[model samples]
Target: MKETVFLTGAGSGIGKAIAKKLSADGYDLVLIGRRLNKLQETATEINRPSECLELDLSLGSQIVTDTVKSWIQDHSENQVIGLVNNAGQFLRSPFGDDQDDWDLLFQVNLMGPVNLTRALWPHFQKNREGRIVNISSNLGQTPVAGTSAYSALKAALDNFTKCLALEGGAFNIRVNSVAPGLVDTPIHDFHQKDDSGSLQLKAALHGMHPLSRMGQAEDIAGAVSYFLNPNNSWTTGAILNVDGGLSLTSKDP
Candidate 1:
């Protein structure tokens, strides 16, 4: 029986890369994202029995929970091997300027992952084996100007990931998180436009990281892949930094 991985935000960037990597390695997939086209594109690329669920994680927290229940019920025989709560929202509001949007960021970044993981916990326990990987960000670990709300939400997620791991250890469910630094993705484009910055500013941000280069989507995906692999069964509640060393290099001081 093939392992089944239920992944959120499996439409682009790191999420998409993870999907491809898992699919290539022969895992059945259940993918969720807001964009149907992108989801379909990912499914097509993988060429496997994949379900692309179009869901806005920010709007339907309960729905995410319920949907996972249904997915588990349907795939009972196959091990629901892993879950990657990789969907997120990045807003450029300076903390309190846009209350509603900031709230939505928290909803997608933190609440949705918690709800979905909680929903899937029973299924993971039933199998006595599972992996949960949260795709966090470097901003969550290090301070970033103008990203107060986003950073706070991600920090909450990191703490939550830790708590989940501690609880899941006895059940053999390895829970971990990966924090990506400056990744070349659409989220960067969104922030650049919102920040009114030149390309050089973005390049400078990428250069500050230890590798002195923006991380590729596959860079983060590889970390997630490692976490999902059953060989690393003893590792849980670990937060890995895939940021090219940006957390060590301070842009402010």
Candidate 2:
């Protein structure tokens, strides 16, 4: 059976980096994302035996679960050994301004992963062997003011990781989470150019990390790879911080 890993958000930024790293490590892929074009680009870049699934996680449990279950059935030949719940939305709204965004965040960031993982549970249980890695955020552990909603959801995901680990242990499934710091991913809008203001902002963010630098996508990917590596099978129920000391700073991004 072909060893395969299903990865959500496998299109750009950190997800793309993770996809590339996993492909290099010899796992065939099932790239899932909201944008088919972007997912296709990632598949082309990796040039591995892979498939793409365009899915909107916020569409509710029935749609997400039904679609993922059907896809798993169709790709049964490729033994799915891992799942990376990396698809998430970031929100930054202060106080009263975030009511609507909170609803959206709960639906997308929290319920999305919840439903998707539930869909994969049966397959993993059947095999009695599987690994799951959640791409959480440093904000979950240490919240910044405007990121209240996002932080709460990520914090919830972290708890879910531990709970899943406890339940999955009987089936030989390991569940872990990687909480990344301020990585120079596409999420931030001001980083697109070398404008003076952007440069200044970067300098401040760098200072937030004791390492005196912003994290690269590869930095977070390395941590994810470590967890996914079969040699570390005994490790589970962990929430690792892959920050450049940014969590320690506890500064607002």
**Model 2 clashing residue pairs (backbone):** none
User: Candidates' TM-scores?
Assistant: 0.93, 0.96
lDDT for each residue of candidate 1 in 1-253, tens digit (9 for 90 to 100):
7788989889998889999988877889889989999999999888778988888887765788777777767776767788899998787666558687677887888888988888888888987888999988888888678878788888888898899898888889889999888788887665555455657677776678779888999998899888988788889989899988888877641
The clash number for model 2 is 0
Which residue segments of model 1 deviate by more than 4 Å?
191-197
Candidate 2 deviant stretches above 4 angstroms: 190-196
Count clashes in each candidate, considering only residues at least 3 apart in sequence or on different chains. Answer: 0, 0
lDDT of candidate 1 vs native? Answer: 0.84
User: Best by TM-score, which number?
Assistant: 2
Across residues 110-210, which tens digit of lDDT does each residue of candidate 2 receive?
A: 88888988988998999998899999999999998988899999999999999999999999999999999888878876464656688788788888899
In candidate 1, position 170 carries an lDDT of 88
By lDDT, the best candidate is: 2
In model 1, where is the ten-residue run with the lowest total lDDT? 189-198
